[model samples]
Target: MTLSSSLLNAFAPTGTLRASINLGNPVLARRTDSAEPGGVSVDLARELASRLGVPVSFTSFERAAESVAAVTNEDADIGFFAIDPLRGAGIAFSAAYVLIEGCYLVRDASPVTRNEDVDREGNRIMVGTGSAYDLFLTREIKKAQIVRTALSEKVVDAFLRENIEVAAGVRQQLEADAARTSGLRLLDGRFMVIQQAMGMPKARGDEAAQYLREFVEDVKRSGFVADALARYGIEGASVAPATPV
Candidate 1:
């Protein structure tokens, strides 16, 4: 059959995009209207979808690692993860979107109050499995015997129940749960910069790579990323332009 000019036009890409957010960040999560995506990552994802003239959809996941898997599995066109090279195996990353300092978790009654405190004590530090924080703990943290566990929520639970001395993870992750345990406190100490960004499956190489770079660049140039981060009380996170300084 001969192709008509109108037929070719209808088949053209509409710049439509699809994405998902990791809902583990309580600051960005809303329980009342759970269907709506309102957090930092969700805001950025929705903005990009709008800019691309696509209908945006929202979904939630229990962990960041699972969110990354959604992308590779094609459940989502894109998903965000804290920057980890190992996580990059099945997907591609844009420039980092935000960086948050990580710290240690201690009981309210524990004497451990600083980074050095964890080091001075016997093994107690535990981190989420396949997390950038875990990589940092292994390479840079000393003094605490680092343990990796899946289901970070459970990790915290185990720490509290199993008589573990200390646990370290993302700042937001701990802050969101501090109230539930009654006596848990996030010890004050800078462990590492947790940089996060969206990842796309490597199968869409050329198109995905271009889209990510442009998305990061556009957000930075417009000050949109900075505004979004600040709106969510995520200070110290800057939107660096893709251009060389």
Candidate 2:
């Protein structure tokens, strides 16, 4: 797609695409051995920059909320995030490029054997503040109380420290935590599915957002997204459906 000068400027105001890299969500990003953020989101950022014919640079943040703030504050040109109504107020989203399952982890001896069992009145759930799992549970879970940690990666530790009934997060994260920490097991099935998408500041206008939407759809249909996931050896994330014509 050929972007007009205005669109190009809107998407890359600094003449380079500044992508807010959220290293918090392990499902989408991770710190490589070199300590730089890598994974599916990084691949998407590089591809977007290449298609725009601009250099790509990353502004790393430890939390998803920080990434959203960078874009809305115009500190960064774009970001990867879960598509949600609350965040959509300031950020315009592309079609989702991937789907991530959100699950709960509990003590091995806990009575909550299934995902549905964790939502009881007395149950306390720990989550990462402002995460897609946090937002979804905040809206959907009426009985369970949500206790939040500063970052998603800290949720498991917080759960253990606080002795919370359950820790809620991306399934892969919960799995890794369970594997490393004894006496914890992930509940079968998932409570939510996060739709991961690229977003720009709403101030950039609908035309720029539309272009990103088209770019995402093109990547999904062309297998670019699938290839990225495969290249990164990322599991438990499925490519989102094509945008309907």
Q: lDDT of each prediction vs. the true structure?
A: 0.68, 0.90
Q: Compute each candidate's TM-score over C-alphas.
A: 0.78, 0.96
Please provide, for model 1 over 146-225, each residue's C-alpha lDDT reduced to its tens digit, 9 standing for 90 to 100: 77677555568767767888877777667667867688888775777777766777776555466666777677778887
Per-residue C-alpha lDDT of model 2 across residues 76-124, encoded as one tens digit per residue:
9999999999999899999899999998999989999988788889999
* Pairs with backbone N, CA or C atoms under 3 Å apart (clashes), candidate 1: none
Please estimate how well model 1 matches the true structure, expressed as its whole-model Cα lDDT: 0.68
Find the 10 residues in a row with the least total lDDT in model 1.
5-14
Badly placed stretches (over 4 Å) of model 1 are 1-16, 27-34, 108-113, 117-121, 139-143, 153-155, 179-184, 235-245
